[model samples]
Target: MKTTFEFLNQLTKNNNREWFQSNRAKYEDSYNEMILFADQLIEEMNKHDVIETSVGKKSLFRIYRDVRFSKDKAPYKTHWAGTLRRAGANRRGGYYFKISNEESFAMGGFFGPNAQDLLHFRNQIALDADPLRNVIESNDFKNDFGELLGEKLKTAPKGFDKTHPDIDLLRHKQYIIRHDFTLKQVHDPNFPEIMSEAFRKMRPFLDCMTEMITTDLNGIPLV
Candidate 1:
């Protein structure tokens, strides 16, 4: 199997839509390969008894990049990205798993300036320091991302004041767990074991999110 690192390196070199069009066959081949990789990842998670929404059954992969408003204006992306939505809430909300030339991550909750709920959800994350701390303190996180997090947190974006009323409201709202790691690092043989350990440590938070979503949806709980 080609590691994500190899795929990403090739992707970065030809990120333009025209290049993608000319190399359409290669793109299709890579897309099919990534679908298989995602399935393998799901199978690995299942072996560890981790419960995740069904993504493998359907071809959830997407090669297009929606850039109608963005300044960069790249209509297509060379990298493949995909998301595994929760069973019924594909449009409204669900976990997002993305891979790109730069990095790969599993981000739950919402994002974008217009995604009010997601932004609210992100704010809620700041309320409890433990979860965030747990992610930051993990050996994998420390070894790979300690410097990046330290720099970003030290100079957080404007209007994220801890004392603000919006911030307070977020503190009370239900928070979702999101974790990201660089694709290059994850492709390492030792990385799967590290990621599995991290996931196990974060299972309680994941369970909490599943429970909260179930209660909110009036649906059966995952646990």
Candidate 2:
């Protein structure tokens, strides 16, 4: 973990093709280390939660940055990240961790759903807000995530009244939660357990999103 963070820190300072190619071996090592860590996290999480994705490089994100349309135009990314989700799940959200010099966090939620999907999600909240509210309001969830964080409309979304009781919940453009971590904690041997617990705390929210998105073939039936 320390080596991984070190590599990422140095990468931030030298985010260029030349430096990265020169240090390809180090990058490979860090990549493998992340895969191993992701595998371990999968095992630990499975003890309490069912995950569809298997342990391997597939679950880890590529270090290369897609800079085609980006203004920064950095050829490589400064951090490595891994994700775990149900095996066949499309884009319903997953458990994710990112390692970087500045800050690292464990996060989960339905992120940036398409316009049609977003409407369904907001409708789910408008119709049945208690289950989602209970999860986000729980002591463990609050302690871990602090609050539901995501983009929201300035006023209310389409179809929902401004005076709706759960209008606040219906305004979200994304459903996500994050728990920050330090480099020291990432290097701890118990880091896998730490990740598992954090993901566990997020299960209720994940489950809620999963159910809302997967059910109702025509999209969350307007209720």
Candidate 3:
């Protein structure tokens, strides 16, 4: 990780096509190391969670940036990131990691849910917020995630009562929980175990969300 971090840190100071092309060999070495680490990370991850995406190499995001829509057009990204999908139709969340000089973090949950799925979440909360609330408000969840975090609307979403007791939950446009790690932690020898355990802490929230998003308000399986 020191090598990986050094490469990325240097890239930040020299963020141009010429510099990346000149350092291609170094970049490949760092990239391969990241892949190896990710592979180990996934193996440990499957111990406590079911991951549909098995190979770490395939899970990694491309280092190249999509510059067409962006104003700042750096040819390559300054970080390494990957995402892991939960296995099967019943499992309904993702696990992600972003490694960079700025900060490193791991996260798990649903993001950008479709309208129907969002409605399902709101309906479940409106029906009885306890089950969902119980998970997020628990000691384990708080100790790791602090609190539920995601994009939310200031006002209640359409067709939902603004004054409802659970309106806070209803206004969510996305649902996720995250754990940040220091650069030292990211570079730790036991990082694979540490990273995997951080994700393991997310099961209570993820399981509750899987139930909410994959079922009708009456608890009928949607899929």
Candidate 4:
């Protein structure tokens, strides 16, 4: 079984469509191998009795990068991303981890326009400063994101200062957690285990956010 790191490294070096077409066998083999890895991750989470809403569904594995709106458009991407979803779930989102030399990380979240629903979400976290602090100051969160996100969190929009009473509150409001790691070290034999460990460790925060947003009519937290 090829590790995720290997699959991603191969992808980065062979990014073009023609390259992919010529090496179709490698792509297919890697895709199937990743599916198995994802399955093992699901099973491992299940063993720990994690609360997951999506399972036993088709996961997509593709090399195409849709850059219709981007200024620096690239015909293709030298990376791989995939997701697993469940049927009949209005709150549909999935976990995705991207592998590339430039930007590589595991991220899972829902995206939406700046509608009333989203505005309400922003207001919810903005209003209740304490609960938001509870989330940010929690030991688990500190361990997972404190080092990586400290600088970003410290410098919010112009209006909000880090020392502001609501600064920590705003930190958890309508934001995304995108943590990066060193790619060279991520290819080691222990990389998959480390990645899985990080995901599992952050599961509680993901679950808590999901539970909080479940009562909302237009929001669904990603895990």
Candidate 5:
């Protein structure tokens, strides 16, 4: 794990193709270490939520960076990332892990839902804010993850009044809970357990969003 962190720390400084190809062995070693961790994490996650082994593979993000649309043309990413999504659920939401020498975090929620899904998410909030609020406000959830973090509309979202009690919640474009960790913490043998507990505590939040996005009430998806 420490070696992995060293590789990424150096990669952050030298992100070009020539340097990367020269150090391909190091990258491969680091990537394999990450994959092993992901595999273990998937197993732990399955104990709480049904996640396919294939999801572990799908979860491990590619290290290459798509430089076509970006101003920064670095050929590779400085950090490794993975996601664990529900086995049969749509890809709109999942638990994500990103680690670098400098920083790392565990996070999950609905990110970039389509217009219809986003609308339904808001509608879900309007209809039953208690479930969502209760999860976010619980001491365990609050202590682990400070607040629900995401982009918000400057004003109220359409069909939602500004004065609504849960206006701030409805204005969100994404709903996520995140907890940052240091390199020291990630290097600990208990890191996987730490991550599992974090995800376990967040079960309600994941369930709330998953239900909203996947369930159909009447003809339309609830979220």
Candidate 6:
């Protein structure tokens, strides 16, 4: 991981294709390191949670940059990232981690849920927000993610009441729980376990939201 971090730090300075091509060996080394790290992360995740993501290098996202649409056309990514999905239809939410010199974090939750899912979440909050509140307001949740995050509308979201008690939770378009890591933290010897523990803390919120989204307004299972 340290070697990977050093490689990414240099990548920030030399983002051009020419430099990347010239240093392909370094890139490969860093990539392999990330793959090994991701494999270990999956092992750690499965100890406390059911992970559907494949083991080994398959868990790691490609380092190549897609320059077709973006204005910044750097040929390589400056960080190594992996995403893990919880196993089974009943299990909802995702796990993500990125290692970089600039920003590194272990994040989980509903990133961009569909309209139907959003409606269901809001309905649950409107009907009874105690369960959701209990999860987010828990000491472990507060210590880990600080608070529920992601984009929100300033005003009421369509039919929801502006003065509703749980309007703050309903206004969210995305429910994201994140724990950012400092460079020192990323470079720690036990970073894989450390990051996995951060992800484990999201279970309460994930379980709460999964129940909300998987059930109808009548409190029956949808799947």
TM-score of each: 0.55, 0.87, 0.96, 0.64, 0.89, 0.94
Candidate 6 residues 1-223, lDDT tens each?
7788778888899999888889889898998888888888899999999999888587788989999999988888898888898999999999888878788999899999999889989988999999999988989888888999999999899999999989899899999999998877777878789888888888889989999989988899999
Best by TM-score: 3
Q: Give the backbone clash total of model 5.
A: 0
**Model 2 lDDT on a 0 to 1 scale:** 0.82
Clashes of each: 1, 1, 0, 0, 0, 0
lDDT of each: 0.49, 0.82, 0.90, 0.52, 0.82, 0.89
Indicate the residue-level lDDT of 173 in model 3: 88
Q: What is the C-alpha RMSD of each candidate to the true structure, in Å?
A: 7.1, 3.3, 1.2, 5.9, 2.7, 1.5
Which clashing pairs does model 3 show? none
lDDT of 1 by residue, 1-223 (tens): 2554464566677677677678677666666767676665555555544435555535255657778778876655655555544344322334445556566665443232234443433444544445444554577655533321111223333456766533433333333345667655566655534444544444444444333333323344433
In candidate 4, what are the lDDT values of residues 1-223, reduced to their tens digit? 3444465566676556686678777766767766665666566545543425344224445556778888745556666555533233333324556665567676544333234434444455554545545765787777666621312233554444556566544544244444455766455555545555655665554544444454453344433
- The deviation in Å at residue 39 for candidate 4 is 1.5
Ranking by TM-score: 3, 6, 5, 2, 4, 1
Give the 10-residue window scoring lowest on summed lDDT in candidate 3.
Answer: 210-219
Candidate 5: tens digits of C-alpha lDDT, residues 104-220? 899988767778889988887887788788889989888889999988899999788999999989999989889888767899987877787777777788877777767664436
Query: Regarding lDDT, does 3 or 4 come out ahead?
Result: 3
Query: Model 3, range 49-79, lDDT digits (tens) per residue?
Result: 7888879898899999999999998888999
